[model samples]
Target: MSVRDLLVLGSASAVPTKARNHNGYLLRWDGHGLLFDPGEGTQRQMTYAGVSATDVTWICVTHFHGDHCLGVPGIVQRIARDGVEHPVDAVFPASGAAYWARLRHASAFRDTGVIRERPVSGERMPLDTGDAPFRLVARRLSHPVEAYGYRLEEPDGVTMLSGELAARGVRGPLVRRLQQDGRVTAPDGRTVTLEECGVTRPGQKVAFVMDTRLCDGVRELADGVDMLVIESTYLDEDAALAAEYGHLTAAQAARVAADAGVRHLVLTHFSERYRAEDEPRFAAEAAKAFDGEITLVHDLDRIAMPRRRTSGGGA
Candidate 1:
């Protein structure tokens, strides 16, 4: 019954539009929360999204762009104010160390927060020891600064089949015993192995990519992810400008998603140029190329992960 997938805090690119706040997103996995980008107005956005600093176990900054990470100061202060003692795993661009230091100490409040630096060193870095809920991997992107995108892949697990156990005369404590021992002696002294009654397979995967041009790294991060959250800062009409600024337009992003075999694509970091009602159009364009589910994110909206398929994979 664990909740996962995306909870958008603010989906706008820069300044808050009437309908949007700024660049902020929360990926709730298991009992842990990951705050990405965390642009301005993130404190209130968290409140609206029902996410507290205490729920945030990991913090990742793709780059130090104002639209991407301007709210770090307030977030840090709030974490201190909330008195969360659990160390937060933080990863930002190593090149932006000075900016991170400034944000970490921006407007000093009480000194009671722990932001453990886990900055990336190269094109790729593995975040976990492979035992975590999701295996995290970072890949460098073609941003102005030392920016990177993140991917979370859930390892495959075993699925217990009740009917299979029942047909084999496994009941009650014996079922529990079989699960724990991976095999058990039936009442008639028959041996039943877990492998015959259970399915152990690969789990789901989700990726997050923001503020990057259509580069190899973007495709690499988006590869086969159940869900991909990325920036669609421009519409197709502004493709020239998007290219000039190393950003992606809605159509281009959708094309990338389709090519990457993404199950669901959540587009965000929109440029303020679009009107409030233009979200549907943007999503439609994205869907044109990527027939998979396309969600044009709004601030404080929660998206549930797609149900796992019979093949033991996910959307």
Candidate 2:
């Protein structure tokens, strides 16, 4: 069985509190594991979550903030120590190349992992994930420092309907021929088209938005996505402070998700100022704007992706 889920390793904004660690998120999609914004103590957090370094295939950094990328050294070293054989791609702002290099080499432990560096420098760019079914896109975000958000989109495909196949009297080689040639001669001497036997399976999408104020890129990344993981570093009461520090309030994040038609909204990267008792306020404010499922993320929390959308059309 294939597994797909979002693993929340750390959920703190500027700094980690006693209960929360820094910002680290692992999105497990099929065979790929994309780690995002790993902050301090992320390695231990991964251990607690039962995620090994070998599981990570990509690392995405929103910016070079200490709270966001401080754990890169440990994670990179751990990857090397564990002898992760596959290539690990690291994506971040092009301007933060210096910071990434420093952290990647910080106390290196006999480097063995193949870490590819792909820096984002434009409005929107696609990262190379080899032959993965989904396309990885990055867009620039509005922040004091250069920041970016990521989106993963799967291509639409066709799903064979068993009932439709049976109705057409298509079986064995005829079904395969219909799929390959778009038309096949059935045993009854009737021609059957691929469209007659299959329904369009719209692909699923997931977006990650962190440490940015409201911007067009944020909505563009979140539009029509199945799940959106975003930063809600502050409450509505601190809206001005949030804007000043390049962060989003729970209400703002919720509004973005609502406008973009996101099926699931995950709000994280909370400030230490909000105590455990105050967590519900964030959810309440977000609920006011977004009617979809909203999750207030905590350390080690896991969220599964929703089912794929079904449609009647071409692949």
Q: Go through the candidates in order and give the C-alpha RMSD of each one to the true structure.
A: 2.3, 2.1
Q: Score candidate 1 by lDDT.
A: 0.85
lDDT per residue for candidate 1 within 1-315, as digits (tens), equals 677868899988866788888888889999878899999999898887777999888889999989888988888888889999888888888888999999898885787648688878698988862344778888999977788999888877777888998889888898888878989998888899999889876577888999888899999999888888999999998999998888999999999999988888889888888887787889888878999888888788889887765444543
Per-model TM against the reference: 0.90, 0.95
Model 2 Cα lDDT, one tens digit per residue, 1-105: 778899999999987999899999999978889999999999999999999999999999999989999999999999998989999999989999999989988
**Local distance difference test values of all predictions, in order:** 0.85, 0.92
Task: Name the TM-score of candidate 2.
Answer: 0.95
Over 4 Å off in model 2, which ranges? Answer: 312-315
**What value of lDDT does candidate 2 attain over all alpha carbons?**
0.92
The local lDDT score (0 to 100) that residue 249 gets in candidate 1 is 94
Candidate 1, position 171, lDDT:
85
